[model samples]
Target: MIKNYRMVLEYDGSRYDGWQKQGNTEQTIQGKIEQVLERMTGQAVEVHGSGRTDAGVHALAQVANFHMDGKMASKEIQEYLNQYLPEDIRVITLEPAKERFHSRLNAQEKTYLYRIEMGERKQVFERKYIYGLYKSLNVEAMERASAYLTGEHDFKSFCSNRKMKKSTVRVLKEIEFEQQGSRLLIRYTGNGFLYNMVRIITGTLIEVGLGQRKAEDMKGILEAKDRNQAGFTAPPEGLFLEQVRYNV
Candidate 1:
């Protein structure tokens, strides 16, 4: 009998290429997990993730599902995977799922976080996780710009994939900004996101904070639907796939 399993994962993606399995010898979070599953089950297995995070990105919680013919307990599988996986990758939960459940297809909402450290002092320990900026950002300006991004819109300007064929229209449920001393955190929740959407939006907001772009330019950028008309894409190190929500 085939058993379907749902898994919650947490990983530090600094060393991996990305979430998706790629060409030969390219290390990825999916590739690593699939390899370990194959070793444990003695059968080839595919782990489907909720989203494809870019290189250098991290995750607090990511969901995936896989089907295999096995009799192992879910808790046992979780422990088994953790024993063989790398130090940076951890299995937080493993449980059986309904037959038709899918990690990506069934997802209802996803939250992404971008962190910027503004200070002259270098963050040595957090260098792999935070985007360090030397200048202070105008928090009020960034907040104003974020308001324009919270709604359904064609996000072609914010996406990095120029050859995208899918619909760029997506509903942004929330866009929040918080500051604690030198640390600036930007949170985005949406029904779905295009390639590099959060990163590009962060860059654009930073530009507004720096006075390089007016806050009202966000509206024009969205209307333009051209990637070149938007601001730069922020570094991947600052991004984290914070959470994924689904209706059971």
Candidate 2:
């Protein structure tokens, strides 16, 4: 009998193509996990994720589900998968999930973090995970700008040009900007996000920080509902899928 299980995953996306499996692409987090599953169970398995993160984007807590015929405990599967998976990808934990539990459908909230380094000298060790901007940023201005993004809004202006079937409306529960030493962190938690929403928001916040845009301009941008009204999409390297929350 096939049993459904949920797994928590973490990966350093620097070397990954992305989280989803594309035709003929072997360098994705999903493909890698599927390969390991096939090896362990000797059967094909389809893993469903909460969402697909873009290439070069890291994840601290990504949730996925799959069905398998194995009888091994969740802990055993976790240990075995970690041993075979590449260093960049790790299976953090596993749990038995209801057969009807769908990772994407069950997810209630997601939090993302974008890291920027505001300084002349970039840390060599952390360059792979952060975006370095030499210009001084106005954190106070960015914070005020971010506040405009909180609450329900039509975020079409912040989304990418890619076609999406779902509604563009989203509820942003929290948006904050903080500076720790040389790193600037932009954190956001929302019920859901449109394609490239976080990246675009980060870009707009950067523009506000640079004094090129005013905090009040965000209202006009959202009202415009045009993608061009928002700032450029921030780099994927600085973005992370921080957490996924699900209703039990």
Candidate 3:
């Protein structure tokens, strides 16, 4: 009998191309996992991720699922994966999942975290994960700008895909900011996000904080629906796929 398995993974994406497996290379998170599974099961396996994180982006809790013909115990599978996988990738948990459970399709919500360091001094250990800005930003202005972004709207201006044929509308449930000294943590929770949408929003908010744009300008940018109207796309290093939520 075939058994479906679910896993929660955490990976440092600095060296990975992304979550999706490509034909040309095996330097992706999905590719690495699939290769290991194929070796373990002695069969080709297709592993599906909750979403595709951009290159250089990290993940604290990325969900994935796959099917195997043999009945391997969850603990055994997890141990085998951890043993064979690279040091940067880890299988936090592995368990039997419902036959129809799909990590991407059944996702109800996803939260992404972006980290910014606003100071002259850069962190040595966290240099790989945080975005460092030389100057401090106006926190109040960023907050006002974030308020405009928290709602259902056409976020095409913030999307990087110009030839996107599908709908660009998305529901941004929340945008919260927490400041700790020179470090700023921005959290975004949404039903789904467009390609580079969160990074673009972060850029726009940074512009507002930098006095390049007013907080109220966000409304017009959203209405314009033109990608050029948005700010520059923030670098991928600061972004992390924090979590994925499901109804069950």
Predictions: Cα RMSD each? 0.9, 1.2, 0.8
After the best TM-score superposition of candidate 3, give how far the Cα of residue 230 lies from its true spot, in angstroms.
0.2
Cand. 3 Cα-lDDT: 0.94
lDDT digits (tens) for residues 1-248 of candidate 2: 78999999999999888899999778999999999999999888899999999889999999999999858988888998899999999888899999899989999999999999888967888888998887789999999998888999999999995476678999999997778987899899999988889999999999999999999999999999899999989989899999999886
Go through the candidates in order and give the clash count of each: 0, 0, 0
Which residue pairs overlap in candidate 1's backbone?
none
- Cα misplacement distance, residue 150 of candidate 2 (Å): 0.7
lDDT by residue (tens digit), candidate 1, 75-147: 9999999999999999999999999999999999999999999988657888889898778999998889889
The TM-score between candidate 3 and the true structure equals: 0.98
Residue ranges of candidate 2 with Cα displaced over 4 Å: none
Worst 10 residues of 3 by lDDT: 67-76
**C-alpha RMSD between model 3 and the true structure:** 0.8
- Alpha-carbon TM-score of each model against the true structure: 0.98, 0.96, 0.98
Error of 3 at 222 (Å): 0.4
